[model samples]
Target: MAPRAGGLYVGKMVRFTSVGLRYAPPAGSSDPGMGQDVLSDLSFELPAGSFHWLLGPSGAGKSSLLKLMQLAQRPSRGEMEVLGVITSRARRGELPALRRRIGVVFQDFRLLPHLSAFDNIALPLRIAGRAELALRADVTEMLRWVGLEPKAESLPPELSGGEQQRIAIARAVVMRPALLLADEPTGNLDAVQSRRVLSLLQEMHRMGTTVVVATHSESLVNAYPGPALRLADGRLER
Candidate 1:
C-alpha cells in the first residue's frame, strides 16, 4: 500500500528493508574481520515528492547510504527499492535507464573544468537526445533560475565555490529527475550561501522532486522544518 501524505496516497520513491552494507577487507589484511558494516538494518520509506534531511556526523555511513540509493553499490544484505524498481537485485544492463531518473550532487561539485556553465547544465538533456535548438532556451532558463545567467559562459574553475555549486545543482535538475540526492552540498559554503542553495532545493521539491540531502549542518537542518533521518554507528536512529 502507498503511504499517505496530506490526506493523499503518495507512493514510495525509495524503500529500504533490513539493508546492510560492508566493505570487503583489503587483500592482505591479517584480520579477517577488518571490514565492518557501515550501514546496518536500515529500514525506511521516503514517499514520493517528500523532502528529507539525512543527518549524521562523519563516517556515519551517510554517503554509503546515498551510494546505495543511487545504485552505485548493492546492499550487502536485504533489499532496496528505488523509483519502484528493486535496486538490490537489478541487473547491470537495466541500471542506466533507472539511474538516469535520479540526479546527484556531489560534495566536490563535479563539473567539467572546460565546459561553460550553460553547456554543463545542458549535458544531461543532450545525453537524452534533446535538440540543440530546444536545449539552448531550456539551459538559458535554468541559468537564469539559478541566478547565473551572466555567468553562463564561465567555466567551472572561473566561478566561485558558491557559483560552482549552484551550477552543479542547475545541471542536476535540468532534466527534472524524479529523485534528487545531494551529499554535503553546502559543506563548503557559508551560512548565507547554504541557505540560498537550500532554497533552490526547496523550489525543486515544490515542483514535485523527491529530495534527500546528506549533511552535518544542524543549524541548516533546524532552519528547515522537515523530517530528519539520523545515522549513528551505521544504524538509523528512530
Candidate 2:
C-alpha cells in the first residue's frame, strides 16, 4: 500500500505485524531480562479512510499503540507500516515528512499557552510554510469548524478544558492530514461535548481521513457502533 496525497493508502493505512514493545527498567535495576512487554504480538490493519475506536482500560497499552501509530515511538520488535512507509526502514530525515501526513489529538490537551487559539490551529500550516494571508482564512475556518471561532484571539489559559481540547483537535486536523489518532479526546468534556467532538472526528473520516480514537469510555464507544480494537495485557482482541 502506498500513501496517497491525503496520507491515506490504497489499502491499509496502518499495518502492524507481531508488534511488541518493552520499556527498560528505571535507570538501573538488577533486572537482567528486558522489562515486561507493554504490548506483544499486536497485529491489526486499519483500512484507509476507516474509523475505529481503540478500547481498553488504563495501562492496557492503548496509549502505547497510539504512539506507534503516530510515529512517536517505534516498536521494540515487529514491523509497522504507517501511511505505507515501513517505520523501521525509513531514514531519520524522512520521518518529519511522514509525520506531517498524520494528525494526533493527545490525551492531555497539549496546547501552547503563549499562542492564541487561531495561532494554535495555524501552527501546522505555518510549519509547512503557508503564506500568512492564507493562514488566517484556513485557521479561522478550522476554529469555526471546532466551534471556537469566537475564541480565536484568546490564549489557551483563557479557555475551558473542553475549549482547549477542541483547539487541539482543530490544530491536529488543520492541514487535513490523512490519518487522525486521538487519545481519549473526550476525557475532559461532558456528555454533550463528548458527542460533539466525536461527531467532528466522524466528519473528518467522511472527508477521507482515516480516524482512530483511543478511549476506555464504553458509552462513547457504544454510541458509534463502529469497529473497535480492544486491548488487555498488551494484546489486541478483535
Candidate 3:
C-alpha cells in the first residue's frame, strides 16, 4: 500500500535542513572548559526508507550525528527534523516517545548478559509497556529473521561475538523502529561475518526501515551498496 501523505511512513524519506551539534567536556579533561564541537552546520535530508552509510575515521562525529537523529542528545545549534519532527527543540517529556521510534546498535554490541536472547530482543517492547503476549510473537519473529532462533534461550556470554552482534541487531529491530542507527556494527566481525551482518541490515532496509550505519571499515563500505555520508573534522562532507 502507498504511504498516506499525512500519516507516518516508517523508514520513509525525511528531510533535514541545517543541523549542528556539540558536546560539553567531561568533568575533567585536558582542556577542561573546551567542549567538543562534533557536527558543524550539517545540512542534509535523509529520505524515508533510504539506506545511508556514514563513513569516517575515528572521532569524526559520525556517531554524534546518529545520536542527534535518535534524539538521544540534542544538537547544540541549528535544527533537525527526523521522522518528520523537529528535534532541536524537542521537550524532555517527549523524548521517550521519540526514542521508542528509533532502534540503535552500538559498536560494542550492548546486550544484557543476564538476559536471554528472547528477553533481550523483547526489551524495547517491554520498556514501552507492550503486552507480554504481543512482545513474544514479535520478538520471536525478529530472532528468526536474524537466524538466532536456536539461541533464543542463550545469554550473551554463551554466544560468539558475531552471534552476540546479531542478537543485538535483532533486539534493535524487534520493535520495528522507523530509524535504525548502527555504530561500527561490523567492527568486530570477520569478512564473512561482516557480510552476514550487512546482509541482515540490507534486508531490514528493504522492509522499509530507514538504516544508517556508521563505520570506519572501508571494506564494509565497499561490500554494502548504498548512499554514503562522509564525516571529517566534525562535518558531513557528503
User: Which candidate has the top score in TM-score?
Assistant: 2
lDDT of 3 by residue, 163-193 (tens): 9999999888877787888999989888777
Give the runs in model 2 whose Cα sits over 4 Å from its true position.
1-8, 29-34
What is the C-alpha local distance difference test score of candidate 2?
0.89
Candidate 3 TM-score over all chains jointly: 0.91
C-alpha local distance difference test of each model: 0.90, 0.89, 0.82
Candidate 2 TM-score versus the reference: 0.94
Return the TM-score for candidate 1, rounded to 2 decimals: 0.92
Task: Give the per-residue lDDT of model 2 (tens digit) for 9-79.
Answer: 56789999999998878786878655889999998999888999999999899999999999998888999
Which candidate has the highest lDDT of all?
1
TM-scores, all candidates, are 0.92, 0.94, 0.91
Itemize residue pairs with steric clashes in candidate 3.
Answer: 11-49, 12-48, 12-49, 13-47, 13-48, 14-47, 14-48
Task: Estimate, for each residue in 1-238, the C-alpha lDDT of model 1 and write its tens digit.
Answer: 3454443326999999999999888898888656889899999999898999999999999999999998988899999999878888888888888787788988889999989999999999999899999999999999999999999899999999899999999999988788899999999988788888999999999988899999998988879979989999899998
